[model samples]
Target: QQQVKQSPQSLIVQKGGIPIINCAYENTAFDYFPWYQQFPGKGPALLIAIRPDVSEKKEGRFTISFNKSAKQFSLHIMDSQPGDSATYFCAASIVGYQKVTFGIGTKLQVIP
Candidate 1:
């Protein structure tokens, strides 16, 4: 239980549309779940996050749905916009661990 992976190397979400991407982890030991959003050539920034104690979390137009038993989670972009077009990554880490493991990455394009 130490690996998390995501799919759909890329996604296209029209203006004002919603785009969802799924992720699964192998480690149940992970307690901190964080989704990051990155612009072109930029470092990933924390978007929204959920702990295993919570089922869902939302921040502004971004939402994270989590499953504890299945060791799965997903990110949802609501009312997406062209400005929101960017790369997203799902990551996890155990408590007391400063390092986090990240997925390959997902590129999202919100067309206007």
Candidate 2:
């Protein structure tokens, strides 16, 4: 139950493209879910996130959704621009246990 599966190893979109990245987990103890965005030579930064109790969340141009029963979640980018192109990762962790699990990753390229 410590593993998280992610989809679409890579994605290519236009300047105004909308891309979606999905992930699934099996552990129910995970209380925190976060989406991270990483550039070519930088560390991953927190994009948007949602808790198990939350159905969805939005921040700036990013959105995240979580399904408690389905054990799934996803990240969506609206009005994607070239700056949005990066490697995205979905992660899960127990609030107080300090245990975190991360998905493989999705490499996104936004063409101008």
Candidate 3:
């Protein structure tokens, strides 16, 4: 099972609010978990990532909470801003060059 599902198709948050998106995977073979951020017409960039060995990971304003047993994960954005408005995608990949499976994507709009 090499499938990852994400929810909340879209989200809106006021400035300084925290927006959260959730994702779940069924492939236990997946060892690398990465969240990607994409602006309009831009390539997805790695925002923050967490390995199976860690329960959570954070980078600056972005945070990733993971649950291995439940095969679930979520991304948290702190101090939401209009500039933070973008599409976020959760992805999973194997050790090698295996294609990274991506979530349908969540559109986040931060109101000023």
Per-model TM-score versus the true fold: 0.95, 0.95, 0.95
lDDT score, candidate 1, position 30? 92
lDDT of 2 by residue, 8-103 (tens): 889999988899999999888888999889999899998877888889999888889888999999998999999888999999999888777999
Off by over 4 Å in 1: none
Q: Output the better candidate (1/3) by lDDT.
A: 3
Query: On a 0 to 1 TM-score scale, where does candidate 3 land against the true structure?
Result: 0.95
Candidate of highest lDDT = 3
lDDT of 1 by residue, 31-85 (tens): 9989988998888998888899989998898889998888999998889989998
Where model 3 places Cα greater than 4 Å from the true spot, the runs are none
lDDT of all the models against the reference? Answer: 0.89, 0.90, 0.92
* Segments of candidate 2 deviating more than 4 angstroms: none
For each candidate in turn, give its C-alpha RMSD to the true structure in angstroms. 1.5, 1.2, 1.3
Model 2 lDDT, residue 23, Cα: 95
Candidate 3 accuracy as lDDT:
0.92
Residue 14: error of model 3 in Å?
Answer: 0.4
